[model samples]
Target chain A: MQQITTEGNQERMQRLVAVRPRLISFARLQLRDLARAEDAVQEAIEAAIEKDDTFAGRSGYETWVFGILKYKILDSLRAQRREGWWQPLDEELDEAAIDRQFQKNGRWDQEARPSDWGDPETTLHSERFWKIFDLCMTALPDTAARVFSLRELMGLSTEDICRETGLKQNNCWVILHRARLRLRACIERDWLAEEA
Target chain B: MFKMMMCKEATHLMSKRLDVPLTFQEKLSLKVHLAMCSYCTQCNQQFSLLHETGKQYEKLIERDIVTLSSGSGDSR
Candidate 1:
């Protein structure tokens, strides 16, 4: 029994090392700082190793490890919030770009109107489409990308997002709106327009 | 002329709805606008699709992590 337990621990450690890159990428998406993301993933892996005995096999090992990493990422986010590590850059410029989509009458500009994306659902299954989507996500302005990821990708509530980003509730909503609009336009232009 | 919901406002409401519950007036105006505006209606569908894409993207990340870890043979 002791020998069996030792082998299990050894296997777990190997698995942890193998999963490190994936954890780093996941953290990078949320933290948006490579060093911080690497730090968070490292901390989580260390914690996982220390607490290996407590890990029940109820879920897949990767899922369980991800749960721990999620907390580490959130803690890093909270620390950044307390430190005022980032400020929304060129916010007025971003807002102005969004406004350009509409005319003085508040209707869409002829050139800015959303085009019909025939069967967007079908694109979800296309790996190339997701590659375009990732490019569009990366193209978002810094603050807008972070806020949108927290609210949409991470499934954080708007209030939690406002607290994390030190933005007011209305500002959070506006950023999310801008992210969606930009992402929509980017995907349309890069993916759909290219196809045509 | 009565103030009607413009496409800009309608699209904003559509995107905002994905994040939060809209107020009654906001919901009503959005509904009214979407009914008359085919463009806004299409925009609404795309907004929801975008939300779904976000969820799917998360799953994809998780799946990739699992595949990467398992696909790599034991490297001590």
Candidate 2:
């Protein structure tokens, strides 16, 4: 753990204050409740400040603080689940709707054909793409969005997600599959279609 | 005919690979489908792009923190 000198403590305090807004925004993306998001961020920052010595400086301060915030968000989610305030993701994807994307023999329909996306990493620098990306992410069903965020954004594994969200393995896989399908379609329609 | 997988099923396997390990037969089936079907291949590519975009977005968010902290520091 890194030693927090008096001067370092003051600097860290200011840095934490600056990062708080971003932390709250992240929490809001997961929690979907503004007041609850704020509360989670507040608790995370307080815990970090109180446990300043626990930061080993192996990671950047912001990264370390965000790690703390991730746990806080999970705690809040678990508490919400325990209190019966959490809603399961909508899993009843319409079979007809899904089948419509395929032909009688299961080949892809013409309309369902995905075009080759050449070097998608090129678009990451585009601010407009991120805006559309954010919209597509937020438009996902609440639980689906959280699952995607935890798995993709936070880089959590499937087992970790099941543990964190109290989801069964099969259910977790189904939710992620549906979420990916929706997100890919949404981006293609709202973002990629526009750029063409 | 029994061994043949549909595009829907292939897509499901493609997505599943991201979350869990597919059995040898499952992987072989998806591979065969991708080989014969341009559409599923493109779909797989699109999913890859989404995963790439997500990782890049996280880095972008991290960079934004430096930008935020370097500014007047009072801006929320």
Candidate 3:
């Protein structure tokens, strides 16, 4: 009986090791702080191992670990919100800046028009494109980046995003919209239109 | 005179639909603009592609981070 339990513990330890980095990635995407992300991943892993037998194996180990990490990330977001770690700029100012990309008549500015991406299926498959995409995401203001991740990556609804980020509903929508426009512009100038 | 939505407002409306349901007036005005303007249509397509790229990029970054950390065995 002792040997069986020891072997089970060993197997679970190995599984946790395999999933650790991914858990950390998910956490960092939300927390945006390495130390906090590491702490969350640590707590999540320990929690998972402690409750090992309770897992019904209904999902893969990674999925289960991510489910736990999600809450941990939310806790960090809430804590940071309470601490007032974020000082979001006036959202209207941000929107006004974005509005300049279009003319007064509501047409795309000459510089801001969306250029044809030429066969998006192939562009999506290109590793280079993904690298540029990541760079653009990182370039966004921290709050905008976080909001975008919550909405696009986490698939969180706007209401939930407002709750998590402590942002008003309109603010959340404005930030998300601005992030998309800026990200699109970055990719166009730095990657696509560069060769044009 | 026909009421025309500006390109900036139309694009904002485009993104707003994702966050909340548009009012009937909002939806009608955007539809009118999109019908006349091919540029806003391209902008809408670009937004969709950006969104799709973000979804795919999330998976790639997760796997890449995992491999980088696991190879070094440095979770800290």
Candidate 4:
């Protein structure tokens, strides 16, 4: 009937509006680029429009849409995997090639300004803070890096991260421990060296 | 040796709970360990810093959600 079709189109448009920003951030997290993330999310919205009926109301609408986006991410990664161009996050983190995080003999370089790194409590949003955080996070081992990002950056719980990552609970704790240690060291060598 | 590890683990777990005060036995063992190991001292500091940082970051990220959407729940 006309009523059902009208309702469907209206609801579909609303879902699009609801899921937009989250989809942008989700894809951005996976792809690490804003444009690519926007493209993937737009593509996902188009797909979700066609399959709206398949969304059985078993879970949240955003979660269901993200499931679709996960497929897109996997597809993108698979294409890269086939091309042999996709590098693991762990292997791709090159300390030497990257702007030289630490000065020679483990001293903190003073050029970037040491006083600013003092309070993570206040300087959390500072460019240098995020830059150092990202570098140190990438320095973590692959599984640990993924776990930390999922738990911290993506705001996933241990149970959710475990399910998505296929890691055991105890393994999750170990990964978290390693991430914390590596991040602490990274901050010490690169960010906090001046004070030390 | 295994029993000692188990006892130490249990005591550490007990220490982690906010509600439970360490018994005299655990308190004594902890004092002895802290007296001997600076690594534990560093770990305690790191754990406190990390916990506080995690709580604050979660709050900040929660606030970062875009709430100015024009559409309400009924907009669909």
Q: Which prediction has the highest lDDT against the true structure? A: 1
* Residue-level error in angstroms, candidate 2, position B32: 2.2
Q: What ranges in model 3 sit over 4 Å off?
A: A1-23, A88-97, A118-126, A193-196, B53-76
Better candidate number, 1 or 4, judged by lDDT: 1
Q: Top model by TM-score, which number? A: 2
Candidate 4, after superposition: displacement of residue A71 in Å? 13
Worst 10 residues of 2 chain B by lDDT: B67-76
Rank the models by TM-score, top first: 2, 1, 3, 4
Please name the candidate that would achieve the greatest DockQ relative to the true structure: 2
Q: Write the per-residue lDDT of candidate 3 for residues B27-70, one digit (tens) a residue.
A: 99989998988888888877878667535644554465456446
Residue-level lDDT of model 2, residues A90-180, one tens digit each, is 4655345556677898787888667765566676677777677778878887788888888876678989988887778788888877777
Q: Tell me which residue pairs clash in candidate 4.
A: none
The residue-by-residue lDDT of candidate 1 on A60-136, one tens digit each, is 66667777887898899888867888675426358777788789888888777777877766777677777787788
| DockQ winner between candidates 2 and 3 | 2
- Residue-level lDDT tens digits of model 3 in A1-196: 2233555456556667766765665567667778998999898888887777777345455556666777777787778778987654436355665776887776788888887776777777777776677678777778888888788766789999876766888888888889888877888777775556
lDDT of 4 by residue, A136-172 (tens): 6555655566555566554557777666655676566
Query: RMSD in angstroms, all models?
Result: 3.9, 4.1, 5.1, 9.3
Ranking according to DockQ, highest score first:
2, 1, 3, 4
Q: What's the CA error at residue A5 for candidate 1, in Å?
A: 5.6
